[model samples]
Target: MGSPVGLWVCLWHLSLLLLSWVGSAASGDCKGQRTVLRTFPGFVSDGPGNYSVNGNCEWLIEAPNSNYRVLLRFLFMDTECTYDYLFVYDGDSYSDRLLASLSGSSLPPTLEATSGKVPRTGHG
Candidate 1:
């Protein structure tokens, strides 16, 4: 026979272990990462190089033939960088669309990057 307090402690430990396992499994699902569209045809040039210090680049699609925006963030670098503008492709050529950009001078030690998509209209 075990004491009530001991049983309670065992139950708490089991719960913690289960929660940890679930968290690990959820993180494992994110093994394969997606690529961001750095360049396109019709759209203009967004910038020169990978401006993001640490974080990865991502493509944000809003609406087809409508306005779209790219969400970028910096990671653990102290370099001051600017997103400047965005460019969209039209199969053949690319046009430069000037817009506001996100910049970060410094970032924390642990920074994770993620991207999401939005459905757009008029796009083929």
Candidate 2:
């Protein structure tokens, strides 16, 4: 086994390497906004072109009727791993049950809410 002092040094270097990969882009026009979706079929994003740094956006998707539950399908995603995240909640707020915390280049699987409400949030 590796010595305890060597293990700690390795871990410290790993943390610094991870932090260096974040914040390479400027904040730009990436502002925080909340969108409420009451329609059946819709789309949402940070707008045209590539998403900038320091973005915090939220979308509250609700089923059109009482008999249905909200479903989310990710068309595409490629955020910085560990630093940026896409958070999915089963209910209306952040205090609800967290369905997934997604990041990196891979596309996440489809998520269905337990109730009629779901919140999708993205932060960079």
Candidate 3:
């Protein structure tokens, strides 16, 4: 039988391959669509193509009424570490509670607003 170390390495490489495939498959452009941000309980993406250098983008997700909270998920993400960032705010604007400040290629876990009418998401 193969050595335990060899088996572990093989499994590691396989996992990386699977992750790459998933990211590419789910990757796509926003297609200049505004409704993706406006619609409730929808998806958010930076698109398949690489984002512009030194560019800033933001989306404000809000519930249909004040009684609801916003939920967010990151299907795939590959931003420049340290240079680029994705910021999530718990309230309607940047002045509100900071929920998460995420970066890197790994997919982050789901995020939910504690108590806010609007949850703002920004990337730069």
CA lDDT of each candidate?
A: 0.23, 0.61, 0.51
- Model 1 global lDDT (CA atoms, 0 to 1): 0.23
lDDT of 1 by residue, 1-124 (tens): 4443322111000010011222111111112232223222112111333333333322333222222222322222222445322222222122333222223444323111111122111110
Clashing pairs in 3: 28-47, 28-48, 29-47, 29-48
Instruction: Please give the range of 10 consecutive residues that has the lowest summed lDDT in model 1.
Output: 8-17
Give the better candidate number (1 or 2) by TM-score: 2
Best by TM-score: 2
Number of clashes recorded per candidate: 17, 0, 4
Q: With candidate 2 superimposed using the best TM-score fit, by how many Å does residue 74's alpha carbon deviate from the native?
A: 1.1
| Candidate 3 C-alpha lDDT tens digits along 15-79 | 10123332212223333222224343444555446776665555556554444556566656777
Instruction: Identify the leading candidate in terms of lDDT.
Output: 2
TM-score attained by model 2 = 0.70
RMSD value for candidate 3: 13.0
Candidate 2's residue-wise lDDT over 28-98, tens digit each? 24467676776545555555455667878677776654345566766656678999888888888889999
Please list the Cα RMSD from the true structure of every candidate, rounded to 1 decimal place: 18.8, 16.5, 13.0
Better of 2 and 3 by lDDT: 2
Stretches of model 3 off by over 4 angstroms after superposition: 1-36, 116-123
